[model samples]
Target: MKIYTRTGDTGETGLFGGPRVRKDVLRVEAYGTADECNSAIGVARAAGPDPMLDAVLAEVQNQLFVVGADLASPNDSPYIPRVSATMTAFLEEQIDAMETELAPLQQFILPGGTTVAAYLHLARTICRRAERVVVSLAAEEAINPELLPYLNRLSDFLFVAARIANARAGVDDVPWRKP
Candidate 1:
C-alpha cells in the first residue's frame, strides 16, 4: 500500500474500529507520542553498545507499537488486545537488571554519553512525556489500567538502559551535584 493514505487529507484519521477522529484528539496524541518513542528506541538500538542491549531495545520497540495500537482503539471496542501486567513486569525486570550494574544514585545525573547513550537518554525523556500525555488522557476517559503502570516502568527502564549503555560503552555518566 502507498504510504500516503490521502484519506487523512481533511485532518481526520480512522481509529482502530470506528469512525474517524480529528488528528488532534487525545487518543491520536497519545498514540502518536508512543510512535515517536518507538522511533527513538530504534535510534538507541542502532547505537548498540552490546548484543543484550540491542536485543532488549528491539523488544521494547515492538511493545511500544502494541501500546500505540491499544491507545488508538476506541474505548467501547472490545476487539483490541490491551497492554497487560506481564509487559509491565518485564520492564521492571529489565530495570532491575540494569540498576544492578549501575552505581548507587546519590545525585541527579546529566544526560549524555557515547552518542548512542545520549540518544537513549533523549528517548527516555520522550517516553516520560508520552506517559504524561497518556495519564492526562486517562484522566478524561476510560483507559486500560496497564497503560499507566507500563509507561511508569518504561521510563525507569529507559533511564537504566541509558546508564547501562554508557557504562558498557566505556562512557562516563555526567553526575549532577550542587555546584
Candidate 2:
C-alpha cells in the first residue's frame, strides 16, 4: 500500500468508525499527544540499557496505542478496545513497586537527571498534555470513562520511573530550588 493517503491533505481525517473530523479537532489532538508520549517513551528506552525500565516502558508503549485508538474511535465503536480500570490499576502497582526502591521525595524536583531519566521526564510532561486534551475532549462528548484515570496514573508512573532510572544509575534527581 502507498504511504500517502492524501485524504488528510485538506485538514480532515477519518475516525475508525467512518466519521471524518478536522485534523485540528480535540480528538485528533488528544490522540496525537498520546502518540507523542509513546514516542518519547521509546526514546527513553533507547537512551540506555536498563532492562527493567525498558520492559515496563514497552508495556506502556503498547497501552498508549490502545489509548490512541480509544480516542480515535467513537464511543460506540465496537471494534476498538476501550481503556479500562485494570490498565490504570497496573500503572498504580508499578508506581508503588518502583517507589519502594527510592527515597521518598521531600521537595519538588526538576526534570533532568541521566539521559534515560531526562527523557522519561519529558515523556511525563507529554503524557500530562495528552491527559489534559483528553479531559477537554471528554467534556464535549462521550469517551471511554477509564481514559482519564489511566492517563492520570500513567503520568505518575512515568515520574516514578524517571526517579528510579536516576537512582539505578547513581544519579541524583535535580531538585527545584528558590531563586
Candidate 3:
C-alpha cells in the first residue's frame, strides 16, 4: 500500500470495520492518544534505559498497538485480539516487581530526571491522557470493558517504570515542593 492514501485528507478516517468517522470523534481521540503514548515509549526505549527496562518498554509498545486496534475497531465486530484482564494483571505483576526494587514513596515527585526517565514520565502522562479519552469514549459508546482497567494499570506501570529508570541511572526522584 502507498504511504499517501489521502483518505484522511478530508477530516475523516476509516475504522477497522470499513466505516469512517470524523477525526474528532471520541473513538478517534482515544486511539490517537494511545498512539501518542506509544510513540513516547518508543523514544524511551531508544534511549536505552536498561536491559530489563528495555524489555518491558518494548512489550508495552506492542501492547499499545493492541489497545489502539481495540479502540479503533468496533465492538461485536469479530474476535480481534484485545486488551484483556490478563494483560492488566500482567501489568500489575510488573508493577509489583518494580515497586519492590524502589524505595517506598513518601511524597509525590516532580516529573523529570535522566533523559530516558523524563521520556518515561512523558509517556506516563500521555498514557493517562489516553486513559481519560478511553474512559470518555466508553461512557458514550460500546468498548471492550477490559480497556479501562488495562489503561489504568498501564499508567501505574509507566510511573513505576520511570522510577526504575531513574534509579538505574543513579538519579534520585525529584520530589515536589511547595513554592
Candidate 4:
C-alpha cells in the first residue's frame, strides 16, 4: 500500500478501534511524542553498537509502538496492546542492571558525552515530554493505569542507559556546575 492514504487530509486521524479525532487532540499529542521518543532511541541505537544497549533499545522501540497504539485507542481495542506493569518492571530490571555498571551520581551532569550517550540523553528528554503529555491526557480521560508508571520508569531507564553508554565508551559524564 502507498504511504499516503489521504484519510488524514482533513486534519483528523483514526484511532485503532475508535472514531477519528483531530490530530491536535491530547491523545494524538501523547502518542506523537511517544513516536518522537521512539525515533530518538532509534538514533541512539544507530549512533553506536553496544550489543546489550541495542538489545534493550530494540525491545523499547517495540514497546513504544504499543504505547502509541494504547494512547491512540480510546475504546477497548482487542488489537491494540495495552501497557502493563510487566513492561514497566522490565524497564526497572534493565535500569538496575545498567546502574550496576555506573558510578553513583555525586552531582548533576550535563546531557552529553559520546555520540550514543548524547542521543540517549536526547531520547530521555523526549521520553520525559511524552510522560508529561500522557499525564495530561490521563487527567482528562481514562488511560491504561500502567502507562504513566511505564513512561516514568522508561525515562529513568534512559538516564541510566545514557550513563552506561558513556561508561562503555570510556567517557565521563560532564558534571553540571552552578554558574
Candidate 5:
C-alpha cells in the first residue's frame, strides 16, 4: 500500500465520521496544530535534561497523540476514544509536582536554557498555538469540550516543565523586567 492517498489534491480532507471538508477547515487546523505541538514535544524530549523529565515528556507525547486522534474524529464519531478528565488531571498533577521543585515565579521568564530547556520552551509556545487553534475551531464546531481544558492545562504544564528542566540543569530562567 502506498502512503500517498492523493485524495487531498482538491484541497479537501475527511473527518472520521463526517463528509470531507476543506483542508483548511477548523477541525483540520485544530488537529494539525496538535500534530505540530506533538512534534515540538518530540524535539524537547530528544534534548531533555534528566531521565524523569524524559519520561514525562514521553508520556506527554503519547497524550498529545491521543488528543490528535480525538481531534481527527467528527463530533458524532463513536470510533474515537474520548480525551477524558483524567488526562487533564494527570497534567495538573505533573505541573504541581514540577512546581514543588521550582522557585516561585515573580516575573516573566525568558525562554532559554540548556538545549533541552530551550526546546521545552519551544514546545510550550507550540502548545499555546495548538490551544488557540482548538479554541478557534471550537468557536464554530461542536468539538470535545475537554479539548479546551486539556490544551489550557497542557500549556501550563509545558511552561513549568521548561523551568524544571532549566533548574535541574543548573541553568537560570531569564526573567523579564521593566527596562
Candidate 6:
C-alpha cells in the first residue's frame, strides 16, 4: 500500500462509520491531539524512566491508542471498543498509588524537571487540549459519554506520573511562584 493516499488533499477525512468530516473539524482535532499525546509519551519513554514508570507509560501508550481509536470511530458503531469506567478506574488506581509515594503538594507545579518529567507534562497539556476538543464535540453531538471522564483522569495520571518520575530521580518539582 502506498503511503500517499492523497484522499485528504481536499481537507476531508473519513471517520470509521461513514461520514467524511473536514480535517479541521472538532472531532478530528480531538483524535489528532490524542495521537500527538501518544507520540510525546513515546518520546518520554524512550528517555529511559525507572522500570515501573516505563511499564506504566507503555500501558498508557496502548490506552492512548484505544483513545484515539475511540475518537476516530463513530459513536454508534458497535465494532469499536469505547473508553469505559474500568479504564478510568485503573487510571485512578495508578494515580492513587503514585501519590502515596510522593510528598503532598503544597503548591502548584510548573511543567519542568527531568527530561522525562518535562515530556510527561507536555503530553499532559496535549491531553488537556484533546479533552477540551472532545468536550466541545460532545456538546454538539452524541458521544461515548465515558470518553470525557477517561481523558480527564488520564491528564491527572500524567501529572502525577511526571511528579513520580522527578521524585524517583531525586529531582524536585518546579513549583510556581508569584513574581
lDDT (tens digit, per residue) of candidate 1 on 66-92 = 899899886656677789999999998
Supply candidate 2's per-residue lDDT for 56. Answer: 88
Taking all chains together, each candidate's TM-score versus the true structure is 0.94, 0.97, 0.96, 0.98, 0.94, 0.96
Report the C-alpha lDDT of model 5 over 34-151, residue by residue, as the tens digit: 8888898788887746999989888888888889889988766667777889999999999999999998988898888678878888888888888888888888878788998999
Model 6 misses residue 119 by how many Å? 0.5
Put down candidate 3 lDDT per residue, 64-164, tens digits, no spaces: 99999999998556666788899899899999999998999999998888889889899999999999998888889889999999999999999999999
lDDT of 6 by residue, 136-175 (tens): 9999877788999999999999999999999999999999
Positional deviation of residue 116's Cα in model 6 after best superposition, in angstroms = 0.3
What lDDT score goes with residue 148 in model 5?
89
Off by over 4 Å in 3: none
Query: Which regions in candidate 5 have their CA more than 4 angstroms from the true location?
Result: none
**Which 10 consecutive positions of candidate 2 have the poorest summed lDDT?**
74-83
Q: Would you list the clashing residue pairs of candidate 1?
A: none
Residue 48 lDDT, candidate 1, scale 0-100: 63
Between candidates 1 and 4, the TM-score winner = 4
Better of 3 and 4 by TM-score: 4
Q: 1-179, model 2: which lDDT tens digit per residue?
A: 99999999999999998589999999999999999999999999999838987898999999999999999998576788888998999899999999999999999999999999999999999999999999899999988899999999999999999999999999999999989
- Give the range where candidate 3 is weakest over 10 consecutive residues by summed lDDT: 75-84
lDDT of all the models against the reference? 0.87, 0.93, 0.91, 0.93, 0.86, 0.93
lDDT of 4 by residue, 92-167 (tens): 9999998889889999999998898899899999999999998999899999999999999999999999999999
| Higher-ranked by TM-score: 1 or 2 | 2
